[model samples]
Target: MKTKKLLTLFLLISGLSFYFSQEVVIKDDKVLLDGKQILKAEKINVLQYSFYSMKDDEEILMFRQMDNETPKYMDDDYYVLNFLTEKTKVESTDFTKILNFMNSRKAMEKLIKWLLKERVINNDGELNPERVQTFKEKYDENITDRTFR
Candidate 1:
C-alpha cells in the first residue's frame, strides 16, 4: 500500500512538471516557449500591412491588415490575424483583446520599428532566415506561405 501511494505521487508530480513546462508566452517583444525565445517582432508596412511569426516546431504567422484597399477578410480593423500551416495544430485562444491591441497604429508601428532595429525582422520585412531554418530542421517541414487565401 505504501509503495502504491509513493508510485502514484511520483507519477502525478512528473506529469504536472511536464504540463507546466510547455507554456507559450508572448511578451517583452518576444515569444517564448518553455522559456526559450521563439519569436521576436513584427514586420509592418503602413501602406500595406504587417506580419510576424512565432517560431515553434512549426511556424505560425501573425498579421494585421493596414489598408481598406485590401480584401475585406484581410482588413480586420479590430484584430491581428493568425495563420498556421496545414500540418500544425494549436489549442485556440480568444484573441479578441490581442487583436484590439494590434489595431492601434502607433503601437503597431513602434513594435515594427523596434523589431527592425533589433534585426528580429529584416529590411525587406521578413523573419530572420536562420530562425526559420532552425524551425524547419526541428519540425522537418518547410514554412508555407499562407498569407493570401
Candidate 2:
C-alpha cells in the first residue's frame, strides 16, 4: 500500500509539471508562445520582417533585421521600432517613442547591455551617454523609408 501511494504521488507531481509547462517555438516562420501564434516573419528583399499581432488591438508591432546575414552563434538581430495597421498601412514614427518608453527604466539598462553584448553598439565607456545616443541615430537612419509587405 505504501509503495502504491508513493508511485501515485510521483505520478501526480509529474502530471502537474507537464500541465504547467510553457513552450516557446519558432516553426514555419511563426513564433509560438505557449502554442499561440504571436509573431510571424516574412522574407522581403534582403531583410526578414516579423510582425506581432496584439489580441486586443488592430495595430501590430513590426520588427526588421539590420542586415541580411543571420547570426549562427547569436540571437537574430531585430528591433521593434515600428508598427502597422490591419490594412497594411505603415506608421510614421521615429526612435523617440522607444527611447522615451525605455528611458530611466530597468529595460533601458538591460537593452544597452544586450546591445553591447551582441556588438550592436560599441563600448566606449560605461558612463558614456553617447552609447545609446549613437544607437538611436543608427536606428533612425535605417528605419527611414521602410518598405512594408
- Against the correct fold, how does model 2 do in TM-score? 0.30
The TM-score of candidate 1 is: 0.28
lDDT by residue (1-149, candidate 2, tens digit) is 99999999999999998887544444575545466664453434332343333344232434433432446632333344343432222222343332334232322333333444444333321222343344445554443345443
Could you tell me every candidate's TM-score relative to the true structure? Answer: 0.28, 0.30
64-98 per-residue lDDT for model 1 (tens digits): 43332345555332333333442222111223323
Please give the lDDT score at residue 86 for candidate 2: 24
Q: What are the clash counts of all predictions, listed in order?
A: 1, 0
* lDDT over C-alpha atoms for residue 24 of model 1: 42
- Candidate with the greatest lDDT versus the true structure: 1
Check candidate 1 and list the clashing pairs.
Answer: 79-99
Cα lDDT computed for each candidate against the true fold: 0.44, 0.41
